[model samples]
Target: MRSPASLVLLALPFTLAVPAPAAGNLGSATTQNGLTAGGCKAMTVIFARGTTEQGNVGSLSGPPWFAAMSKAVGAQNLAVQGVDYPADIPGFLAGGDKKGSAKMAQLVMQAMTACPDTAVVMGGYSQGAQLVHNAAAMLPADMAAKVSSAVLFGDPMNGKPVAGVPAGKTKVICHQGDLICAGTSTILMPHLTYSQNAGEAAQFAATAAGM
Candidate 1:
């Protein structure tokens, strides 16, 4: 099994610039309703968005990184879902949000329950990554077993690893100079550049999802 550090290194070369999608393409209206609408799930990628003061869906709209990821996953005929949560600083600094994480975990468990044979791939960015890690770690063993892989970007908790995800099945992507991952760049550009890596990251997520 490759260590998480090794996976981050492997992701470095693919983290190049790509044209940004139109602002109109940010995400789908389906996000407003979240994942509970219920459909047969062959595969699903649950993404928790980064920090926001907005309600559930937040303001982190489409042309969003997860939308690109969903497109890639969809090419493989896999379904995709975005999780809506209070991804705020207060939630993170509190160590973890009992209500928010529990809600996230519940959605995950529901997905697992509804799609017993479906492979689940979960991921997040920045604080959202931390939330996914916390939620996945809190899942019942059987539910956790259903999750095939986790892909995280600019995870603030990179140094303090989460407990549930096995090293082999998790991939972390921190840009060369992204300060969030402890890189030296003093700018937020690195933190915001994940859209450039959408294609590569989605491909990685697909492989992790066993497609």
Candidate 2:
């Protein structure tokens, strides 16, 4: 088993964009290095995953996933960060481990605060999806409003709908073939099930464009 910090560090290479100072002193947005270009406003998108299992982001080559999605959507700039936590963190946190959740929530809030002008998008796979939802729920109403869209993949709402997420701006994508879909949680299923290797990337781009 990997230590929480180790897992986070390992996952960092996959999602972190270069850290850039938000324009006009809006704090620094965490982004992959060398991925930013001038004359483009940066947007922060948080990528969360399930069961503490890292996603394909670490394995992909070329630009970072968030940058690619941002480019696809034509954003001037983009930043992506992964929400790292132990697989059992949620369970322990729910069982009164407020410290852990609160700490994680604070980290997320800092990321959001750093990019005040940038639109925010939250995406998660499996367990990571739930973390994003929970983090979004914890945001102050004003901060939550900054979020342009939220995408939950492979995980249902699980009876905990993220408050303040505008219905029109939220989307859910799930794999029908994945057994995780059989749960009774509340999430809008994707139009097509089955695996789409690049589908997640495409959907993120399309959604960002719509925002």
lDDT of every predicted structure (CA atoms):
0.60, 0.47
Instruction: Please report, as a residue range, the 10-residue window in candidate 2 with the lowest summed lDDT.
Output: 54-63
Clashes of each: 4, 10
Best by lDDT: 1
In model 1, residue pairs whose N, Cα or C atoms come closer than 3 Å (at least 3 residues apart or on different chains), thus clashing, are 25-63, 26-62, 26-63, 27-62
Tens-digit lDDT string for candidate 1 (70-137) = 57666345555666676654565554455666676877787788877676777677666777778887
List model 2 lDDT by residue over 1-211, tens digit each. 2134533444344334433333221112222322122222455565543443333112121123454465465544555554545534344224212333344456546666654566566665555556666677777887777677776655534335566877666766656554344453222224112134344654654575364
